[model samples]
Target: MPTPNPAALDFLQTRRSRPAKTLCAPVPDRATLEMLLTTAARTPDHGKLEPWRFIVLGKGAMPRLAKIAEERGQALDLEAEQIAKGRAQFDQGHLAVAVIEVQRPSPKIPALEQTYSAGAVCLALLNAALAAGWGANWLSGWPSHDRGFMQAALGLEDHERIAGLIHIGTETSAPPERPRPDISTITEWVET
Candidate 1:
């Protein structure tokens, strides 16, 4: 029989993402963040390609990225609200990890699988931070998707894109539980 881990199951069941805006200072130090990143890097990679990498964005980098967001937003002619929404996280972030998806050529694993691996890394990092007693939220906005902004701010190459920017810091307040999807409505059991 498989060993049961009730505590792990409970934590997963109750896991909630802290809002990025609610995250505050006193973020994880380098050692702790390294541990979290190590945990996150254990995510499954079909081809052992390790198609994702992390970019640690300290508090000092936030304002710079926010400035880039502003310029890119203006260049794209984004509405004021849209631009603000995109820039808000960087403006307020204490610390974050940018999960970059670096697509690697693989014969057995397809590009879609590589993308999935990158996405999994994002969630893994987010969960790792939360599990380590830090408030964490996975976020992506227009700035993240903007090619020019990513290249200028993160020095990303053509094959690399921002999978997510995971904000991690102390939680100011616990957010109320939101409605969850009904498993019965979303699940389908098949026997063939």
Candidate 2:
């Protein structure tokens, strides 16, 4: 026999990411955000490497990051529309958490595993925020992938990279449920 948490399972089944652009004000306070971060930190860490960290971006920091994104986009010779898209997330963000993947040297755990762990943290944080009744979305765009932007905007080291940027705020309107993947086609059964 196995113990079950129906509520948790139900929540997982119903979970859907809110669009970042649709997220508005009344973002979680520092205390509340801290609780969510703590929950996110509980994600599984192979070999106990804990190769991830969070950088909370408050509303006041949005403009600076947005500007950096614009500059980085231009420096990379990106199109005007691409530059706008690169900066849009920061321009419209109220609050966001940057989940950074920090690679630690380990003979036991591979770098890919560390990356997977970091991604897991991002999902955990997003889920934590949603479970707490906040509109949340995990995003990553050109800015996140640009080393120049990462250096100028976030001051990340060479070994650190953005796993995700999770935006959290009040929901202005409920999002329509999107189509889900067909699980049967993706699943496999193995027996020996």
Candidate 3:
């Protein structure tokens, strides 16, 4: 007999990520955010190597980051619209946690596994925020991938990369339910 957790399943099915642009004030406080972070940190780590970290951007830091994004875009000769796209999240962001993938050298655990762990952290954080009754969205822009941008914008080292920028705040509008993938087509039942 299957013991069904209706509440958990309902939440999983109904959950929708609010767009970063749609997130506004009433961001989670430090105590609440810390709880969410704690939940996120519970993600699996192969070889027990916690190859990731989080950098929470404070209240006033967002505007500065937005400016830096704009400057970096101009320096990289990106068009104005593209530069604006890079800066938009910061300009309107209420709160953001940057999931930093810290690659630790290991003979047994490959870097890909560590990368997967970092990605798992990102999802954990997103789900935690949503479960905590806050609107959250995971994001990664061109600036996250550009070495100069990551360094100047976030002071990331060579071994560290941005896994995600999770935006958390109150949602201004309810988002429509988007279509999901057909799981039967993707899943394979192997009973040998």
The estimated TM-scores of all candidates read 0.98, 0.99, 0.95
How high is the CA lDDT of each candidate model? 0.95, 0.97, 0.93
Q: Which stretches in model 2 have alpha-carbon errors above 4 Å?
A: none
lDDT of 1 at 140: 97
lDDT of 2: 0.97
- Candidate maximizing lDDT: 2
How do the residues 12-31 of candidate 3 rate in per-residue lDDT, one tens digit apiece? 88888999999999999999
Q: Is candidate 1 or candidate 2 better by lDDT?
A: 2
TM-score of candidate 3 against the unseen true structure:
0.95
lDDT of 1 by residue, 95-179 (tens): 9999999999888899999999999999999999988899999999999899999999999999999999999999999999999
> How well does candidate 2 match the true structure in TM-score terms?
0.99
Worst 10 residues of 2 by lDDT: 171-180
True-vs-predicted CA distance for residue 94, candidate 2, Å: 0.5
Note the clash tally of each candidate: 0, 0, 0
Per-residue alpha-carbon lDDT of candidate 2 for residues 47-130, written as tens digits (9 for 90 to 100)? 999999999999999999999999999899999999999999999999999999999999999999999999999999999999
